[model samples]
Target: MQEDSPLTEATSDSRGASLLTSREPSPSDHSGRGTSRRSKITRKSHRKSRAGCVNCKSRRIKCDEGKPSCANCKRRQVRCEYPANPATSAAASGLVDPREPGDLPISEIELTYHWATTTCHSFSAWPAGVARVQALTEEVAMKNQHVLHLIFAFTALHLAVCRPKRKEHYTTTADYHYERALALVTPEIASLSPDNCDAVLQSVQMICFVSWARGPQAGEYLAFGKHGRSDWLVMFRGIRTTLASLSRDHFSKTHGPNTRGKGRLLPPSDGPFEYEKQLMELKEHIEFVSEPADRDDNVNSVEVLQEMYSNRYGGKDGEYHVAFGWLYRMSEDFLDRLQRCDPLPLIIYAHFVVLMHDLEKFWYMKGWTHHVMSGIYEALPIEHKAYISWPMARVGWIAP
Candidate 1:
């Protein structure tokens, strides 16, 4: 036989090498098999957790499985609700069935009603007025989304303010509902209509209280304070203007030359009433107090001092008239100066707190006088502390 060619010899060598390689596993082959095995093991070990509370489960976190409230939600101070079994949760909780036609979920309706009766009471300066507003709001909220959202927003804000442990949760809920109310009412701000006027007014009032709750305290002035009283004053003016417009429109429609003013639609305007006269007296007192001693020829004028005393505390009209009267007559410039932390305005504000003491019978104004007075004391300079002394004394605070 002829000697094998070089090409035939090489081919035979390649076939032998391929057979040897197939017999022994390479590094890459071992790595691929190891990875596949690990993946299968991981898949087998992973299981969905059904034992956790709804909040933890939804967040894909491990739950401590505490009863009623899980550790995760308890730590966060959020509502710890479990997933209700379709057959039993509603009945167990005493909740109305949500499937009924024309009926809202019981929780929502109950919350809204609670807010109207209980939470709203805290914001009203007058119980009778709040009762009437609550009745009207309940009647209107069913038909108007704007009113409904405002009620929820007020409820959430009240909870946020009153419940310190759950403040974050309630604040978030308040903001969500407030935004919803704002979105619905923004379009109607410019266009006033009889149909939406009541809802709009109620919403504005609730929003003002919400703003008050969120406004900066004395401790927060250096860091978190915004425009302070300037923003509140602007809202106050806006509310007044809106009410005036509503009153005018209502008057024109209901009263005519031939008809008596029998049916009034809007509530009576919040007037200074007798407080108007008291305001004039206060203006005079302020002038007297601010007057220089040298300018007065009668340095020991008993009559002037006596009149000042009478007006200062609203002698016969009572302190409420004097305090609220000053508030009613306070100028925009005064509010602006207050926001700027002007010493004089702060001193005046402190004095006003004395009047607030008498008005604390209103749930909304309770503790406010003390809070504002304390804030002023903390914020003022040492030299300016004397200016607040009389007011502080009036409010039963002793200087330290």
Candidate 2:
């Protein structure tokens, strides 16, 4: 129970005054003001939590007793956990001991709840698509431990972005599950078949999402990693090689794809022409380069981007694939240059992500445009940085 604030204050001050006077305070002590005022005060009784979290109790605050993260701890951006209830201890006998801040005990249910309710809806832009993806993710994750881990990984990473105060906590959890998913998925990838295809494909998508969502470091631009390695690219080639052995049925779609192609192209003041103009100027910039091999590698990359825009992609199609599908279509040479931080390809990529405005609106793709574009703009030299101004403006980035 909370102490009576006014009474406690008056009694303490009166005793201190008495000690200074070498006697106890009387009715006239301290000008006789606090005793009468304190006597008029009445303490209110309020209910307290019976099972508050340890974090809340230590801080002498109230707790809503939210699982996984209590309201107070979530607000404070710290870990929230309750002391085991003696009454429920037997029921929790099977729960794993949480090894670290990220490793939550008996959290499969909590994280899965988050996955089914919130994170699952992030993949698809439309309602029907959302329902379909949600069903598929739940159905597939049920029979696969790795898929479940992937779901939890994706959910935790999303939480990290949404709750910045708990970033380290959720990031660590995301990283733990991401690694767990890789360990379990590796064996199945070696022997991919129709039976495991659905699970494997879902896992693949989650992995890619998590990687991209986590942002790229200086040594890692786009799919490239440290020492100029095609990190995510190589990972895909392996999965692609294995998937090629399967049939068209393994990769069936609920709906045929839609493309806001060049046929829907608008005028000079509108998007298609203006967007293509940036890409066209990109190719022209590479064309003026002194090195033939350098010009060819970068120009072909820009051409691939231009062609993708002109042919199958340009407008808002409400399809997430339309944004990054070119990654699969891009040449290995171009991808290598991207990994190496080539100024031309880097600038081209900045333009490419302008197509990602729709994607950024997606829950998973949220903040990706800002995160990636900021990196690209920083990586470019001052002279080459001018190349990305259109994209910078498009994404609302003002370069410093």
Quick one: best TM-score, which candidate?
Answer: 2
lDDT of 1 by residue, 1-400 (tens): 0123111122244322111111111111001112224644553233234655656887898766554456787787654444545423444344543232442233344445457447756633345445544555554555556666666766776666577787788776666566767888888777877666666666665666565556435443211124354444555456556666765455223221122212222233232234345435544544566436322322222223234334544334322323343544455555555666655556656655655666555443546566667777876788888766766766777655
Kindly give the stretch of ten consecutive residues in candidate 2 with the minimal lDDT sum: 22-31
lDDT of 2 by residue, 279-305 (tens): 777778778962777777677777777
| True-vs-predicted CA distance for residue 26, candidate 1, Å | 60
For model 1, the stretches where C-alpha displacement exceeds 4 angstroms are 1-107, 123-130, 159-168, 190-195, 213-231, 244-247, 250-325, 359-367, 378-384, 398-400
Clashes of each: 0, 0
TM-score of the candidate numbered 1?
A: 0.53
Candidate 1 C-alpha error for residue 296, in Å: 17
Off by over 4 Å in 2: 1-106, 162-169, 215-218, 230-239, 245-273, 288-300, 307-316, 381-383
- Evaluated at residue 399, the lDDT of candidate 2 is 66
